[model samples]
Target: MNTRPAGQDYIATLDLLRLAAALAVVLFHYFFRGAAAEGFLAECYPLAAPFALYGYLGVNLFFLISGFVIAWSAESRSWDQFAIARFVRLYPGFLFCMTITFAIVVLAGSPLLSASFSQYAANLSMFAPAFGQPFMDGVYWSIVLELVFYGWVTLALFTGLFQKRKLELIFVWLTISALNEFFLGSGAARLLFITEFGPFFAAGVLVHHIHAHGRSLPALLLLAAAFLISCGTLSVTRHWMQNHYGIAVSSANLVVANVVMHAALIGAVLLRHRVRPSALILALGGLTYPLYLLHQNIGYLAINAATPVVGKWFAAVGCVALMLFVSWAIWRSCERPAQRLLRIWLGRAVDIGLARFRRVSTEAQPAE
Candidate 1:
């Protein structure tokens, strides 16, 4: 009932959800994962393991939010505005976090997680596979997925294939995703087309379409299909968890997590204008990106060092606080400033390019 025009302003509730997602991921890395003892935290903090066991669900939540937010972001802008906004939003924080992680890993003697120059250089591209290296931090995989999602969005915008043709796009994407994820299980498809993770993003897009366009029958059907596909394909994430953590995640828990995530995301959309936007909401949202980018590898190494000096409980706690602080500092110092400057410069560039294109078009009119 409180829905505003698409892309008019930020949906503040999603900011709160972003904070929750980031915190969930932190908890997941700290406790639920088998690798907790492998790097930082020294040993699994058994005290929190019970509570944190399902925190990995946060990534799925983040993906859902990303779909919704990105769709909303592109709704009322030219391709250039969307591109610049995304670049400024993502890159500076990424560069800072990656560089810091690289330095810390190099300085620390953690060979298992240590970096090579090639790896660091590859990571600078963000799409590290192009340069023949893995992500600088394990957490970066999600961000890579986000970038891939952005690329497709850009293509859709460039071709002007969205809106009038959105349902068709979603159907084709869902079909490809289903084949790759469920039937063919092609890793190449998963990476190139984001087939494995397409449903979640699709779900988010459907939510946006429903919200903005008043939930037409066809859109509702597509939304239902997308949700079911996402729910059905969740086992991919479950299998990965099992393989990595050696922990059996019950199917029921997975269902519940997905269900809750769905409800939460939809509720946020429904409450978009119902909830008052505030500086605090904006601030919290602003910090989530930097927090996520900076938290994992560097935090692990920091925890590994501090755990010895301060003992396990104090070390983990202290390091969590420190990482949060560092994240805030990065947001305030690096990310926000970079976004401002980059947006200004990109605005000028876009204007000049548009001017050039207009002049060329005028020159080519041929006295008509």
Candidate 2:
């Protein structure tokens, strides 16, 4: 979504996208949480299961946003500055969230305590991906992709490639994706680094770049095509079809479908920004992070707590609302303060390092 000029600071369409992704994830987790069908509510309804199947697509949208936001967030910066900013922005909030999740698990009779120290250490460092093992905490696997992208962005910035050869770098990444997914037959690897999703992110960057360069309809159309192809490829996975429609489709065709749909959706949203963001839309979008993290487990927890009274749908809604409220409070109280402190500290540390480097260089200079 295009960032509007300053003073407005509002883009209704992106908020809508965020809200839609959050809902997709919430619905996905609602059915897939535990006990398979979640009893009759899912089994009888049948509609809920499809949501669960498609829910994983939320991650793709996120990758797209990350690509756009990273560039958007750091449009004017030195490499050190951008890296420092990204670190400060992500780590403090992440650590706090991790700690919160840890506390909850311990209270909920965590099996983790019985695990070996090596196992515990692996989790603490977010090492599940390296082991090709699933994690105890459900949301963590997604972070692996985000972190990889962060590393990629940092490397690009350090080499001045982000500034100098941006388009070339994007092409190189797309080539790697095609090679890995098709030639190498490494679907898992393609999914991991979000190599397959790179085009979506590239589209986001292109959105901003084109807007900055003055908009052109033809350029946007090409971007739309790229987005469609990328998303289509992802949608046709065997797991997605079986779980969603109970009918398997060839991945080759699924890829094409995903690409077409993603492009169309993004284009529609981008073109429809004249509409204002309603309060409800903002509320839903605001819940996205908490929904992403807590949807699965919270639904289970809610079902257990409200067993006598609340049913599945009620439990799902209540869990989503409760998690959203809790997350909002945490964001305000903990996340904000932590981020502010991190920024100050990171900036000061960078300044000190620069000063020390200058001092050393001055001492090494020939007498003048």
Candidate 3:
């Protein structure tokens, strides 16, 4: 029947999938990485470590989903509109979560975690690393990558290339990603082009293109290439884990995990129609952002504090539940209302700036 949904249609399955990815990341931090060389946790879960070691791949899954969602979001939006949407979508939750994390770190007075006012102020810009201040939570490095991706998208939209030459752009991006990753190995290129993670994002965009438009041969081929490159790029993560955690994921295991994630994404889109959309599904999706932002450092502290009273496993479970609930509350009370207000204000400001620019251009036109 070829019942693929349009760009405007909400995919309830994706919402559920996003929540699952976020939970995977939470588990990774709590069960594996925390107890690894970092020693963020006092108690260790040796039984769960092997499985949770792979959970870090959830961030890769997130970039893939983001590529799809961002491509879909940009379909009919102007550059300014897209910018506003991205800002509204990200900044509110980020601001709320960052503030909450900062408050908790200060209150906890934990020797392991601390935040200063300058750090908080710099984090407000969401690029605290540039200002010689650390991110309050370590997970924010991924958020910065996301912002860079958004910046590139916004630039593409402004140039009209996003609509007219999206595939070409993806091709160029993938080539650069491969070159930098395999041959050049330039740190600057890696950061600027997101070479390490670009394939996941590119694969995601191709998935959306195939679903929305059709299975054109170029799209399919590019997708295959993206998948292959994405597998190769996991070595970067492997090396990172080795350096930090003293363990490395086997290449075969990485490939298998990558395949499963990509397949799951494809299946979610294909089966989205079978999953009914509801407020619950939407709310589950909404909490992922705040949960990701809030889970790492604060959660370490929560588990640390509660473990003494409730024991390790109980503290871990309780922390996850508390994080989920707080994330939901923030989504409902803070992100939703703030997004509405920010969208309206940012939209109006953009309109005013655009109108004034148009008037100035018109006045500058040559007359007969």
Candidate 4:
């Protein structure tokens, strides 16, 4: 059912789902990955590690949601508008959170976590690794992937391909993704086309197509293809976990988790009518971006600092609560205002540029 709430273009349920995915990632980092033999944590939570190990899948969930959301967002705007909207949405929050993380790491950084002026400067571009600098926070790697995805979407919109030949485009994209991931194993292709994670993103786009335009045979088939490809790509994550922690996540569990995540996306779209949109729901969704951006390294520092006095469980829980509050504050106090200002400035600049280009074209044309 494509019944969105009146006067709203977005599905409110998706916001809640985003927050849930963010929390899962936070827990995964805190309870499982942080405690590995060479992990960041000073203490381990053996009990929670088993369940939290699966939490890394939350990033996969975020990609799926982003595909649906980006497609929905691009549908109603011109290419420049889409670009501005995405920039204003992502950059302000990223800057604020990145700066906060930088300051924290500089002032109170442990050997495990620290920052330099060059690194911070590189991070300002939002693609730090290209400049031979590491991300100030490890979580920024995902943000870079997101930026690459947005770059592709912006290009598609510019060429009118996204609007006119979206399904065909997705087919080619999925095909390339399968080839590189399953056979070629080219790291460049993996980075450029996002081969490893493209299926999750493509699945999201197909889901949006079904939600908005109604499910057709072709769309359904492509979506099924996406699901199968996604299951295969889970091997990438399994391999990483094995190499890093020497733990193997079974293929069966990975497939089951992937299935459940895809199912959840479908269910959210179908039952969207049941979620009533409210300011609180919007805020929860808003906070998730900053929460995801700020949670990892800063959280490690916080947990390590607090664990001795308050104990490990309280330290972990308290750090989460603190991060949530900080993220909410950033969303409300920083991101909203900065976005409003950037939207105004960027909108006017784009309008002026487009007007000049039109004038030049008009003057260059012969009188009819």
Candidate 5:
């Protein structure tokens, strides 16, 4: 979505894309392979199951969206402001979801696929395992990837590299990702830099450059390279599908997902002219982060309990509805308030700290 001129922040159509990608993920986990986790769905819902297999592509969709938007967010702001904005945007929803999930899982007595107090403490930082605490849900792995992406973006912003050398940086990033994924193929590389998945993020960044500036032959070439590299590095997902589910993930589906994402993103930019912004759409987008964060483990537990009482189809659909409602409530009650408060507090703190630094600098200047 194109960032409108100042005073026009929200883009309605992109919000719809957010909801769609999140719903695809939920369906994949709940209806398709969801049975594996929830235990009540069984070898059931066969009609819908086959089609849902590819829903994991939603995560890639999400990465693309983040790349576009995060770049937009960073384009004009100081790194301090950018960091604060990202924190308030991400952390509030994350905190609410993590705490809520921990409570639900614990109270339900199905806790700990390996849960413990130390892990719970670690989860507060959102990097979980770094401090030796497990993530409240497995879905958190992507969140960490997002944080790493942000780290790089933040570094770029700090060095003034992002503004002047944006395309060059993307080219370098894509090259590094390709070399890491295809050539080095090191486990540590995948873990820390997550180079295997960097192309998707780079593709989104390249798309943003195209969206903001018009398409150039050079930019188009880079976009093409990023997309192809992403396709090549999909070995991780394919291997995951085969190992975990004992089924091959079709290469055609991988190609289709990539194509669809390119179209969706490009289409958003194209339609930016036609699509008027709406608050409803903005709110819908707001619900997505919370919904994505809260959906997986808790939904599984809900499904397990509700299935016998409600019947499978109704239970699944009903739980989806229930979570939507829950997400809305979280948005209204938890996320908005927390973000507002954190911003106020952080703003004052940054001000105080900066003031102190200025004072100390004046003192140290000595007869200047």
Candidate 6:
């Protein structure tokens, strides 16, 4: 059996890092109930506050990794091929999870669920809650953003914008981000999908380019600066209309910071080879999607069930543990198997298309 230990190289190392990030998110929720201002849930946990605070960063880490990994996947393929691959990779898991979540909500008789069949249909299609209303799955928002990024990448590829000049692309996005930071408030600065994140995504693309170009002193310095800025460790303050603009820069700044840190972390993992303890990390990655989807609802249920029996801390812990266990089981069973099935189905469709094309070509030819 060619079970092939999955992550054996730099790419694998990034996968391991992704798993670690997922675990950080899990631990963050487990301890702090997803609230940053709150301290540890219990006296036994000292690291909870820092960990929970960084949980939001974990999602950005996934986005940064997604951009880098998608660039890596799309490198050798044409736009159409890349789009199909991305669709197959993302949609199947997403749809399945959404359905399961909606069903669970319905079964649980949550008042938040749609009252009618059409409303349920809308939720299932992922287009519901279009006007600031949260969707059936709280985690679906990020999925939507990811889909937008995928569409943007596809458009860039078709327009020849992604053909060459990787760093130039990154710089262009950075400029947009900076300029947007300067002009528009943080709210409007977020319109950078067309204007900004391209660079961050391009930075991921630049990761491939940097390897080809070879690292230089200047490049290293720039990367270091970008890293510092993204991590919010760089102490630079500029005025933004009475606000000190310390933590509250442009939305573009926060986005850029996230992408930069993400790229740096992925790059570092790829560059280094040493493996640390990863059981929890691996488990977290496997369960992240489900946990993210189910955590809030499950946590609520858990609190309701346990608040009467024990204190909030004990109840929260038990709930989180139960959620984790259920998510892990789903990942092992439904999620992994469903993904495999979808891949197979998509592969067969591609094969059929190719076979039909060949047949049409053969019939059209004259006697040869």
Question: Could you tell me every candidate's TM-score relative to the true structure?
Answer: 0.92, 0.78, 0.97, 0.96, 0.94, 0.70
The numbered model that scores best in TM-score is 3
> Clashing pairs in model 6?
230-257
Question: Taking the candidates one at a time, how many backbone clashes does each contain?
Answer: 0, 8, 0, 0, 2, 1
What is the C-alpha lDDT profile of model 1 across 1-368, one tens digit per residue?
01122438768888888889989988777665634435444566778877787887788889888888788888887677778778877888889889988888888837556788999989988988777898888888888888888888888988898746888999999989888888898888898889877898999888988887886988888878888888778888778767866665688877887889989999998888887888777677777877787777777676667777878677667766887788888888888888789889989998999999999999999785
Query: Each model's C-alpha lDDT?
Result: 0.80, 0.60, 0.90, 0.90, 0.81, 0.56
Question: Candidate 4's residue-wise lDDT over 1-368, tens digit each?
Answer: 01122234667889988998999999999999887865688989988899998889999999999888888888878889888888888899999999999999999885888799999999999999999999988888888888889899999999999999999999999999999989999999999999999999999999999988998999999999999999999999899889878996799999999999999999989989899889998889989999999999999889999999999999999999999999999999999999889989999999999999999999999999
What ranges in model 6 sit over 4 Å off? 1-10, 27-51, 109-119, 131-133, 185-203, 211-213, 216-272, 276-284, 348-368
Consecutive 10-residue window with the lowest summed lDDT within model 3? 1-10
Please report the TM-score between candidate 4 and the true structure: 0.96
C-alpha lDDT of residue 8 in model 1: 82
* Decreasing TM-score order of the candidates: 3, 4, 5, 1, 2, 6
Model 5 alpha-carbon drift over 4 Å, by segment: 1-9, 37-43, 111-114, 365-368
- Candidate 3: tens digits of C-alpha lDDT, residues 1-368: 00112347789889888898999999999999887887889999998888898888989999989998888888768888888889888998999999999998999946988899999999999999999999989999998899899899999999999999999999999999999999999999998999999999999889999998999999999999999999999999899888877898899989999999999999999999999999898889989999999999999998999999999999998999999999999999998999889989999999999999999999999997
Minimum summed lDDT over a 10-residue window in model 5 is located at 1-10
Sort the predicted structures by lDDT, highest score first. 3, 4, 5, 1, 2, 6
After superposition, which runs of candidate 3 have C-alpha atoms over 4 Å from their true positions?
1-7
lDDT of 5: 0.81
Candidate 2: pairs in clash: 28-52, 228-259, 229-259, 231-258, 232-255, 232-258, 232-259, 233-255
Report the Cα lDDT for residue 144, model 6. 66
Say which candidate scores most in lDDT: 3
When 2 and 4 are scored with lDDT, the better candidate is 4
C-alpha RMSD for every candidate: 3.0, 4.6, 2.8, 2.4, 2.3, 6.5
